[model samples]
Target: MEGARGSESGKDPQHTSLDPFQVKDPNKLAINFAYMLEEVGKVAGTWARAREDAEPDAPVSGPISDLLNTFLQVSEYWRADQTRAIEAQTRLVSTFLDIWTNSIKQLGGEDEENPVRFEPARGDKRFNDPDWERHPFFRFLKQVYLATAQWAEEMVEQPDNVDEELRQKARFYVRLVMDAVSPSNFLLTNPVVVRETLASNGENLVRGMRMLAEDLAAGRGQLRLRQTDATRFTVGKNIAATRGKVVARNDLAEIIQYEPLTPTVYKRPLLIVPPWINKFYVLDLSPERSFVRWALEHGHTVFVVSWVNPNESHAEHGWEDYASKGIDFALKTVEECTGERKANVVGYCIGGTLLTASLAAMAQEGDDRVASATFMASQVDFKYSGDLKHFATEQQIAALESAMQARGYLDGLTMANVFNMLRSRDLIWPYVVNNYMRGKEPMPFDLLYWNSDSTRMTPANHVYYLRTFYLNNDLAEGRATLRGKRLSLADIKLPVYLISAAEDHISPARSVFEGARLFGGPVEFVMGGSGHIAGIINPPHANKYEFRTGGVTGGETFEQWRATANVTPGSWWPHWQSWLAAQDEERVAARTLDPHKTYLGDAPGTYVLARD
Candidate 1:
């Protein structure tokens, strides 16, 4: 890496030693702080006088008053926070002075360990250059930034008075501040960007500007880090190239029936319910990594729901629409094609949520079409739905609804941005620095491409989902209704296999465990080692990660279950296969699709290809 750093020299005549001090100079930062403080003081005085004039004799009791009081309290908290920050800065300055004094006394031979060792966080490659630590000024700046970030994190802890909604927002804002102040975001401070600029004779910067302009134009002024060139992968060609036929199609979904690879198949057919937020091909990305292929090879007839990339015409489609017109229809189609009354079902992410709801609804109506249920990284209980809850607040939902109303659907780009922010260090900023700052093209990664190729949600569908599942959490509470009939997870008495990603941020493991407990039947909960996507798509051949499994009773907590759970190495697919086979009837000759219902088309159907 050190040798590579020197290779860029003499590439550009205009290149010079980049001054780290030029970026985020303490004196300049202090001046900016002073200006902000003065402005805040003025605003505070105006607010005080206005409050005095408007509510001279009124008791602060109304909603407006409550909001005002909350604001004042938050302001006070911020003021105290600022004081602490200043004291910390003072201490840092004092330490720097001592270090400078020692350096002079020993003629720069002071060999005591540097008070601040700049260690980048996991996955943060910006400060990987040895040059960053070798320079005293850069090292000092890194320490200051890290210390400030730590202080900000500590300060952002919500007080008892702060509501959950406000607390989440506060934490989000604090994170934004931290991200904004990261030394790598700037041109001068980031060694990689500086080196790239010099190596490319400033061409990288020009190319970056052009890319920025193009993105702005394409995304309607929203800054989207292009993770992959959209043209690199095409559905049914190089991506979701799995062989299958579209057995059924509706306004909401295209149900694909995969051809079996084995001579014999399980008596019960398998149906996959994938989240509509993304294309169904995540399970069928390519032959090597395709879970669909794995299942088919294991002697099980597989079916996948390819949800339509909804448009303005589908704006009125809500959760009910997804339940009735989506999975319900898929279930009926599967039964019709296979001549089987009962089928095994697997749901991933939001698709799992919808499947759970459908099962509950089916149970309520005394419809016993489902033989067994498998939920993959899906949360039925929203109590601990993870960071996504931050965007489910009333105000946030309303704002989102307004945006959707104008667009007729929640734009895929907008949804992508929200998910990216949850892991911005890995998803957003890295791409920003690589593509925009260094003008490097994004690598052709199948998973990242799938992540980028998102689908839009109808306005009504999105709003209803956030409010019903995320906000009110009506489904878990048995308050959610479908087609004038109330549904309860307790009503669904079928055996269930729940798989949750151990490191999932979208659906926390504990939340998934809670969902598993809701089933009033034998539940086998498995914890996979990776995150939401990687965890579910884990194939047995790779033998990449491990999984934990144990009988989960309704009484024990997630931690308690984990304490004595059986830890098994390698993919959970084999375990799932065993459980699924046990739930299934005896193997029979592979069945073909019904001749009555004509085959629509090949797998990775048109619906998956339809982009918003």
Candidate 2:
């Protein structure tokens, strides 16, 4: 409301007229439809050529045939969607007429007591203005829009046998249509914007246009929908500022050891394996929320793996390279530094997945150096990887592979966009309104800053990850391999502690539950409160959310476990610390660093600051 503005001509801003023709042009849509038809024709031509070149009796069931079939199927689905859109528009017209009729009846005093009413869907704050319901015409228009949106959602159907990727694509396109036509998105229909336009006398519109242009330049023409400025936060100075020193460095990762806080420490050390997709500092965001600091204060020796931001030279690095040369190397360094045989290992997200594979490989080779394993929001079983599976289809993966082949790595911006879309309402749309429509600057926040500091994935490693774990789902099926040796999760009989976020969209809680069952040993699975990042970073003092923990014996479903698990308030970190304490031997004098083995410079290390 504050940022909105109308024209310089002193027109009634609340009823400011907008060019109906300028609302939306269908020319781009027509062009896209024509292009799709042309592409389909090309595919058909290629198929015909292939058929003619083949032997008379030979079946035409190869790559070209598959391509043609996919194109045809997509076109069919598009046509179905077009029909649904038409049906929704017809419903809109009928609803409009009904509203008109109802208004007349009310005007004639036939239905004065039961007058026409329009309310937005519960939790939809877009049309909460009392003025919309006060006027019958506004109410009718709002209802028509809402009804059309609902009809669009209901009518767009996917066949049972259609490719999941195609279905997902169709659903996404449908949502795009719905968002585009929402009254809240338009200048004329948005009450708050209209009111603000009247108050500001067109200045806000000029400011909004300038903001939009700046975002276009800064975000490379993509909508800059983030709430935080990417350049405001520095790694070591503010974020990931936990005190520590790098003790060892390898081709893949840097091992950092935090200085001890207490007079004595547990005999076994704790090593953290953070996801390589982003910088490791998510675990050590700031002094107030740093899990690394918490672990140190609790009298445990802490070590973390900081993976290098890879490039063309490291493009050939694979899972084996990460597992063998990354985690394996970190574990050996922890042992050498602490003078201990085993270390309690902790992995978050993809790092946890890699840790699981590495642990299984180690168990297969009869190495028992791992004291225990903890997987936080990580999934070894990809069967239920949630909406992200939409991008793992063979065709999608092949397209991604081509992109990576040309660049030597998957661009961080590409990966960030995919994750952001998973929670667009929370992460994308609000910022569109705030930064673009409202003409406001982004606010500073530590978590969002960390989110913006993303890292690239080397081509070889990323492709193998998508193919083996996501596309094939080979890890859980006992078919995945590491360094030419087949890897299986069941082989690892080590004690396990698994944490799953109740609202995590990335590694869904149910999938994490299934992953817990894959371990062939005692497992303590805990359901943490909130989504992927916030759930894990919640500190004990915050007293914000709740967690549930129980013994998981691999025989019950996630729902079953939830039904019987003990619900505990506060962070899960204390429970984990208690569990770690139980697994410890006699406490000893705090260990000192082995100065001779130390390398690299400091706490966060150079890898985190490396850019493409």
Candidate 3:
């Protein structure tokens, strides 16, 4: 009744032309803001005291000092005041959501036993607050919350000679207020952090209620686990269902097949190898967006390795098992099924890393059936990358290795946790405050849905990868060997296409392009736009993304070519397709499957989309 009265009593019904969002009581808003700020001052005071107490033994040494100074400079975050304002809003939002959710829960929304009190934003939607704030209802609500928060902060700063207990209460209120006003809370839902935060709030009545909106958002949208009806990618009986039937499977492996669109497969055989870190279908995410499907349409006979989702049951299988099941057996089948001398191979991310390893393996064995290799955003060197490197330290990797021992495979959530940390602000925080306080669902978005599809990696495979390539730089240096093979990059004398994104942290652009020097074949290395995922999924509908390419190194190192190259925007796919066509002969026989060979039902063969 009070909120309704403020909306109606303060308004001129006929003056609809006026901005309805204009709040009548700026003083109320001002008072609330003061309270929030006072609380913030206290926080600043606490940080200052902590800084003094641990004065760092008379300041850090030269380089360390420089690093600390740099850290201190950025600590202001350039939006301190904005952050303060947010703190105030968080408090109100928490209070309002707590009251609102409880009211709704009591009122009931159809489901009596476990009623859904509020609706989340569209499955994984992000909000544009300016647009929403224009509405009288939201604007009024916002003003009240902000004003209340400001007042709370003002009290914290006052000369009340308040006890530590009172000061702590003030800080909590300030934290709540800021939590509500976060940009992430407005849109972009389905974060792992939001779920955890909401769960924690469950113990604290009001705090938990504040998180209801985000919690509900996580439960419903792209972030949430959904039981979707199988999508139709082809015709009846031969539709491109999620992961096509595993035509060939055994203890060592499974060869999964996609339902073909055309009556006959391409003239040349195509092999796909996905990394064990995640599922394989990143190439075949959906009918429209799948790169694998695109190749099939262009008349290239495509065979994707649908990896087996491994658990403790296959704990014994190490990097050797994956090589045998994922790459080795698949190659054997490619040769057996098609009488062709060689086939084209595409390796994505870690799959590409492994492909490079396999190439060395093949080179050692003198198996020259593999023709051209396409590496999509895969890195061989990790030292040059930003932020991600900080977490890849020896200690961190050791800790992670120890943790993954209990279960043979690293939990999908564990990997997700690390990834989220890399870009916490972009990935985790907003959903945190908003879900807990505002009680609104973030909207649905396809990209976020794709991100949430987490994947797990076995202890052995992950450890070998971290130790061998990422930490050791063995492959980049040409010293790495797997499966007792004298693996060397120079051995795999085949044409190669290496793709990396400029802004990618997982595989830095420089690190990715570095592979060109390792091969003795024609290397067409290109730098793309977007980070790791978006860079590879460079579809036309994709946002402002691009790549840089030119000057084929007759034979050169990664840095030399990068120095002289120029950058450009748009799809590298067409360019790659063109390059791939010139080098290869037409497929002799169409894509085919044998009922004789069964799928092994394990690793990068099928469960790529279930990574989350």
Candidate 4:
């Protein structure tokens, strides 16, 4: 083994360091392996500590135990065998070259403290590490050797799937020493090399991989969004083109109106509830991408309540105020618009949260004008909340509250940063590396562009939401009383249609499912594909999600109901549309803009088209 650890002379080290674990009597080799195990154990311990602090009530999944079992299995495999050795000579030669080139910094260079160093031929920003590109040939050599050595370790355990008798025997004799290379073994055997290597240059490798993947996938996804241009809405034409307008007046709160495409016969009125975090066009973004247009075209009357892009003036408005003024005022005006006793309502994201509160308030005081409450990406059960809670600490909340107090309103950029951090890989890192470092612009994405154009959250609204939803599970367990009335999910049970995205990191599917169960109404909970934007934009007529299944007899877990429910493969939208239509009537309602109550201006109200 000592013979293997020869001096670095830019040639294949003359000798190689044999793993001590392979020795029959070298107890020191066993100790070395133990040290590696300890290193991997520390990582697990850190994760466990974080888990306990993050969500103590949440169930510990079986996957963790399964992973640990695999780790143990690999360790045992490595300890017991090492007869047929890997042809690692080629790999060792390359690593030897790297060590020789780096030996200048190791011995002669001023950076003697640096264990790994290489001077760049030129100062290029593409390679951030200044001392990593000294010997290109040597670096390539190291990668090749490292890849093969790792491959050799892998082949020891993963016997090649060759049915040929002679070939299998030849393979076993020449390269079968890989019993030490199971998926579980890496943690036990290669902690120092893995950690030190990753720590030295992991950033560039991770960033490069992500950027490469993004670049490759961009064109394919672009085709999906751009190839489709069928409907009037798809071509970016809406009711505003035919017989409507988009008015953005500074008179009342941030409210947008998309009047009917044509006059209806019976005339049913409706209001849109958009989240404070975003400008309201999510419902009426573009013509084909606009749900608002769909509603208006179908003619049941529509008015979208876009949140006042909170400037200093609206800093004092809390959750209660949003519910009371934003929702209550909007509903009152909507009722007055068509002279309907109870107007139909639709809420998306946090908009749904406020709507649920309004319904609870109305239910408490007998105001069920919001005949049906559609919750899109809204969760009532805080018990199963996703990663958002990880960042919102009490101290952070206090800092935010104090900051918002000083500024009068939380900045749009501040809110945007938090959401971006929620999915840093997809939202921030790849584009950062590509556009900034590699000098490539981000692939144009309608959803991403919309998300990037953030809206300022009212100081009061932002603070209250964090405290109630993230800090404490108030709204989920029938505790959060927004405007004088406690809002239990059961309290707002009005033919609820709750939709959640399966791939959403902000709101996980299980969390959404649990929240939907809180509503005792005839709840039709849908699981859409993709993340937030892709999930919401899913039109039911398309072959998208295979997620919409039936509910259990009463409130039950997904596991309990998926057993008997009909397994269908497509978007849940058509099903939801059918259900909603069946609940009411199919009459083309005679909905004309109310002369006295209507804002009387344009299609996209100022609030809806607002950028931040």
Candidate 5:
């Protein structure tokens, strides 16, 4: 049999003598275990403090609990079955028997091929350690895990077993469970963790325990797994470093006017409305990836809304306030600063939803300040909103609202946790194994750093958004309203450009494509080549991903639109720039900040700097 430890030589370590004492020194291990116990005590103290601070007898089912209940309800479809149960059991046992036969053959040094064939999906790096392949015990564990996970997914996908809604929820919840229980997450089963534990003489466990305690304390009893080195990036210094000035400030947002990088600029200014859930720096992270910098260089006067991180005082703020006091206020600021009656607008994620609704209201009022509109990974229709829709059920939202009521706002970390869970395998578990299991600090990453910087959402706005948008699907159904005015997407007549990432989870491309047909004016729908952030922030210089573009005019379905789209190489930034230019080819000398106007501060204003 192969040795437990990996070898430098190409030859298998099985030929070498293995000494347990060499792997771990007994004396050192004992001392480290004592240290680990001390950290465990500290961790307990943090948990106690958290319990005291937590709301007593909080709602029965917050988001996490609600999801678990959904999983349970959906799981009844399989649990109640007798024949299905026996079939599942038979398949599982057969796979295990095959794995056993293969392990025995490998142990006996037989050259014959065995029947057990199980491989992780491509891009799965959980079992990358060499021991997982070389060591018989570890190889057996890998096969068992893969087989079980595949069986679980198969159960969820069984024909006519459950409705689509339950099936989707079941699939999502099952994946989370499977990922959380992976052999790679535990010390005994993971080859890398075991190796590290032995090589460190258990010192790694001590350090890992200390980190666990510190993180628990940091999140006030909740685990705030650090995804990146937070100390590496600072807003307005390295991140969100685009040169600009805050020209206007309101209760909801600060309007920032970026300095021009070109000698000439377009006649109309550009206003960006980013989702308030995260800091605005995502668009301005480092010079190389900064979308704000790219737009400035392309001869566009850029103005972005930096939403105030809400607190108890802002709890009363709702969707109408966000549309009027946020986007509308920013539009008025753009005109005041540039002396242009009309300006171009871009909204990202939920920001785009607000912009779309407000645009319709503006149309009803005969307000045409916005010349053209662009949506970046934003959805107006919720029929195909993906797993996120699972959290918007009437019961779940009510429970979440109760939890938020005491605090007046939904904690930023709470919202962050939801987004993280959407891609838990990549966002949650890797960091778990790296930081807590291996006792190592994560590498400094600008995107993850920005992701960690989340902002609170007012309870009123959050509840209303969940109810009106996700639950009722009122926006797409033409029943959505703002400030007592019935809003309809078809009422907005401005030429619109819509871009959706092909792999976006929060706003699926299908949902975004469906939304494109609701517009009354000419619409351009483009599909970018990555998930939400990477797809939209893809600068042309990187030349990393491709995009598909075609005019969206008819009532064709998303699949038909995709079939007819023309694939273009490289980033969609250039295409958007060309589209913007085509709106009006007129140009003028680049304008400087109005010295006579009252200014709040530099770009990336005070609101984005407000942390939880």
Candidate 6:
């Protein structure tokens, strides 16, 4: 093993100085391998035991069957065209030959342009290691994998005779398959993992397997891939640390009134409605990045809805319950605290969707308590929505509903996995490598910690949301209803500010732009850089990403509006603050939640702390 640590001259099979597998001790490696196998057996045993009493995975069956059927359809379509099938086969064979020829040329010390050349997509970190390009063995592996992946994608694309929907699903599933089988994901194929495995004398595998077993146990026989150091940060103490008191509490949510930071505050209080899919802390991550703290400092009375991490008892809750029991209750609480009849409201993601519907419903009753509305990274029109739409088909939604009905609610882990699958390469695979393959824990990240802290969705609410919003496209089409009253976005005739991120896969920018037009009042649409979370949590101090603003007039396409929009550097928070100020400039003496009022708890509240 010591002699195998050769110089970086590329003469030895173990080219790097760290390679320890050349003269490995068979007994030591065998012991470690035995321990790993034992751990894996433990994981499997735990899973089998869990299955004894566990409800069948309702949500997974539909999507899995759908994916399989899509591939079957593609396979039939490909086979139907003999010429095309033969061509695809020939192309794949030619690519393999090219790789072989290139390997031969490199072995003979011949300088020649390779017949096959491929580069990993920009920002793909899997192949960033120098050895991937410098070492012949690793280089060949990377090229071969890339070539095969490209060929598979081409096969999916060429089957035009198949239904467009099936083709799209096929493309998506193929990508998932390719990402899973990438050379970087395997131990011997990935140069870095190979070195790590050798350097640790197989200890890495033992430790990694032990960690995997622990994770499986923690998730009750399911893999809850650890994204960050969960033990490092407590909710109220470190992450959602903004000073506030939960002045109003109910079965669905707690309304928190933050401590005032200024002598005067906006007469119109600000109420924030966060999506129940996760906790409300994403906006209040830290003091520096806390949007709650920022609003307080800007002389606005901020009230946030911290939704309960629900359980089976709350299974009967629906969208109307969330609107009336959650937002309406919070709104009434804000009015009582600040003596303000009208308040500015902000919603994020699905929270925004609920707010829009609630406001429209309020308008029907002539309730004008909301002065202005701000939507961040949310969608009302699912027509232009992203890949998530693929999962919300009628068949899949029915399966999801049945699963939720059987369990009384949808598990947070199931929902989290569905969202993570959309960006599996970034959100899923990297963690697999670092946690299980490299035998390391992820560093403490507040955002990912918040992500990991998920909440269950009530069956009634989730089913209605998927069917009404995703499938039927009801909200934008004036067909959505709540609390026995039909609601329409056009009925909400208040100043509206809509902002979306350019790279947001959850809610596409075009979808947000299209939804913006549905508003009856003046709408200002802003496009920000980065994805959903980063773009929204962007603090002014970071000045990291730019945002574009344009007047959203009727009859203009999304492209047209973006083309003529005014670009501004830094966070959109300041711009949002300015727009909020314009809604109602009246300033009154700052108010805090009265200590005399029956308070539930601190800023984060108990609902956020609950975990399954």
TM-scores of all predicted structures: 0.84, 0.80, 0.62, 0.61, 0.95, 0.95
Candidate 5: how large is its RMSD?
Answer: 2.6
| Each candidate's clash count | 0, 1, 73, 23, 0, 0
Please, what are the lDDT tens digits per residue for candidate 1 over residues 1-612? Answer: 011112145332222234432443456546544554454454455545545553111121332343444455555655667775576567657656664554343223344544433355786676777556555445555656776666555555634556675665566656755786788888777777766665555556666655665565455545556887767887788888878889889899999998788999999999999999878889988688989999989999999999999988898899889988888899899998888989999999999998988888888788999999999999999998887886676766776677677767777877888799777867888777877678778888788889988788898888988999999999999899887878788888999999998889899898998888788888889999889999888998898889999888768878999888899999999999999998855989987655565678878788888875
Residue 551 lDDT in candidate 1: 86
Cα lDDT tens digits for candidate 6, 2-79: 112234434554434344335377678788888888988988898898788687566567888888878888888678
Clash pairs (backbone) in predicted model 6: none
Which of 3 and 4 is ahead in TM-score?
Answer: 3
Residue 403, model 2, lDDT: 71
The TM-score, computed over Cα atoms with residue i paired to residue i, of candidate 6 is 0.95
Q: Which regions of candidate 6 are displaced past 4 Å?
A: 1-25, 74-77, 159-167, 596-598
Poorest 10 consecutive residues of model 6 by lDDT?
1-10
Q: lDDT score of model 2?
A: 0.75
lDDT of each: 0.77, 0.75, 0.57, 0.56, 0.87, 0.86
Candidate 5 regions exceeding 4 Å error are 1-11, 14-22, 55-60, 63-81, 553-555, 594-598
By summed lDDT, the worst window of 10 consecutive residues in model 5 runs over 14-23
- Residue by residue across 151-191, what tens digits does model 3's lDDT show? 45564554244555334434443444444453345422322
- What order do you get sorting by lDDT, best first? 5, 6, 1, 2, 3, 4
Q: What would the per-residue lDDT of candidate 4 be over residues 1-612, giving only the tens digit for each residue?
A: 011123454433422222321334345435544544454454345545545554211122222333344344444544445542223444445556555555533333223343333322253222232112332322333334344545444544454432333232333322222222211123222333233323333332333334344432432211011111122232123422323443333332655555567566324566778787866666655455567666666655777776667777887878878877778878777665557766667788778877776777778787767777777888667665666664455666776677778778776765766676565534554454443223333555445556655677667778888889877878877778855666766766678887887777777777778877676577887777777767877655556766556663555776665455565677666666666666676465566556665454555545545544
Model 5 global lDDT (CA atoms, 0 to 1): 0.87
lDDT of 4 at 78: 41
Task: Highest lDDT: give the candidate number.
Answer: 5
Lowest summed lDDT across 10 adjacent residues in model 4 is found at 220-229
